[model samples]
Target: MHKQFSDVDTVRAELLQNLVDDGETVTNLGSITRLEVVSRIEEVTKKIISSLSMEEAPVLTLKSRSRWSNVRFSKLVGLLLTMGGTVSTLRSDCPSTVMKFALILKALSAIYKLVQSDSYVTKRDIYYNDPQLFGSQKTLDTIVDDISCLLKVPRRSLHVCASTKGLISGDLCYLEEDGTRVDCTSTVVPVSSSVSGIINIVSSAKFVLVIEKDATFQRLVDDEFCINFYPCIIITGKGVPDVNSRLMVKKLWETLHIPVFALMDADPHGIEIMCIYKYGSISMAFEAPTLTVSSMLWLGLLPSDIESLGLPQDALIPLTVADERKLNNIKKRPYMSFHPAWEKEMELMLRWKQKAEIESLVSIAPHFLTRVYLHNKLSYGGWI
Candidate 1:
């Protein structure tokens, strides 16, 4: 009462030949329901799997009615081998060939399971290599390290739940061994004066003043000059701003709409430091555009000030060849392209190969700064 059907290979060959004869490129074949066809294919695959010494079993190919069909069958067999533990054994026995294939298939399966399952792996568990080499271990480890360091959490127990029914995004909390929840982010502790001092200044200041050297700030404070200035905050030492400091400064300037003024020495290094503060230092991981002062407002020792102060000619700092090239290259910048005043300053510096410090000028009489000499002649000309 039943009609005989061809085996998988015969059916596949027939289908392919039919495609070639009709000049139709077979994109796919309809769902295969024939029991005889499936049985024959399964038998062939089982024989292939059994024939290869466990070491070679993973690379076996299957005959199918279409390319898609072959791919699906191969994946299915790989899944089976992975689940059956034969894949791991084969990998362990022969590492170079079978091991790599098994590891790849297992990784894919793990990822698929991760996506499909309701339970999610934490950012910590996924990173830790306790299980074995899996999906992007190095990348995962680096991410975990960064988050742990930034949030100041112990790496061993840090875990973040996926946004489900109740959890908020980016909320890192602590979890116990038995999965009890503790709100680490909620506990408010006393804020340090250094942090609070900066915050208070940000809150009150119309424009924040950032000074590089501690001694300069000390001199300003000691002289009791403009101590009533609410918004002026000084950064001590020569180091670039850290992440927390950069973020705080950016938030004050950008979010609060406050202007920022930076004071530093007049040398190449000082200029570079100010630029880095505004544009972000390459060494530090932090970046914020709002934290920089305008280069046009750069003040300190002008070339004329150096000559007028009667400071030793030897006090002028020398410019390297690289510095000369950098000065010349500034002409090409969109913001600073071709200023005669800037060119003249560069020419003077190159001629003498000397650099001047802001402290030198700051150490001079205030009358000199306020009256007889301005930081830059260009400022007086209204070119800035």
Candidate 2:
């Protein structure tokens, strides 16, 4: 008989020892087979290697040659795709990461040598362009897999925590949220500031003027006038203001019984911004249930002021079918349900497609603004 140490017992001992070393508690030492023991050891070793490699992951720094070539290839592909899908032909013109294997195969062929025999080149030339062979594909695959997994999940799920304050983390600082690492510390600070500012103002003011543009807000401050002639706060910056700003403004108005007057440009984007502010449907900004400020009002860009301001004929951007239908439906509702001024303004915008900017009226004659507009709009006691 061949000398056979008990295979099953030996394997079970080995697997139990490996599991114990890997911080796993083996409940039954006798339960494992030799094959299972070997497999478990391999798996544990692979996990250790993966963790070490991740900790030692090399930073990808773009050199001048790499940057230029990458940009050139990207531009070529972008242009080709833009011009009716000519990317197949353009792929032949450059070696891009997207087609690295194909390019390497082509470069190795006799055809490639025949095309460039006289040219003097160094191994560095090929190495710089094809660094992946020298680098690690495993690392790249891990990163890509992580990104793919992240993209499949809902953005709100990425937040560290959700509270009445705002999204704690996992918000896309620039675009829509992905699993891309963001400094939660940096994002939360500004949100806190915005919340604090809103709380401060809402506690004091009888009404808040949420001005979309800084320039228009400056003009209002200079002239000492706003829609409701009440103390106001301006949301200055690009796109829609952040979630914290909207929440702060909304809570202040709702809790303090202070009304919010949204004054924005008369363009489609501007109107959409006001609607988002009033009704809270901007999913990208915040995930909370829709919060409509019952006291909120739209109070600028009246139809009667358009012709007098000499605005461009093209200033009248067309309303969408949805907007037209909304305005029409609002008109049929009882007067007590909606503000008469708001209903009238929406109807005028739907019919004429005309919009007037607050800037246009700002440049009007001082006499007209002070005597005719301001005096009529604001009472002697300075109430709107």
- Residue 174 displacement in candidate 1 (angstroms): 28
* lDDT (10s digit) by residue, model 2, range 1-384: 011112333434544454455454443222223343334324434644575577742111111111111111111001000111112221222445334324323333321232234232333344444466535433333222222121222111211111232232111122112232333212221233223222222123445556666566445545544333443333432336554556555544444554555667765556566655654331221122212343355555555556645656654556677766655654553332335556556666877865566655545564444345534433332111
Model 1 misplaced regions, further than 4 Å = 1-206, 228-231, 237-239, 255-258, 281-286, 289-296, 307-314, 320-335, 338-344, 362-384
- Backbone clash total for model 1 is 4
Give the TM-scores of the predictions, in the order they appear: 0.40, 0.40
Pairs with backbone N, CA or C atoms under 3 Å apart (clashes), candidate 1: 205-231, 278-292, 317-354, 317-355
Q: Name the candidate that leads on lDDT.
A: 2
C-alpha lDDT score of every prediction, in listed order: 0.38, 0.39
Number of colliding residue pairs in each model: 4, 0
Identify the leading candidate in terms of TM-score: 1
- Candidate 1 TM-score, C-alpha based: 0.40
Worst 10 residues of 1 by lDDT: 75-84
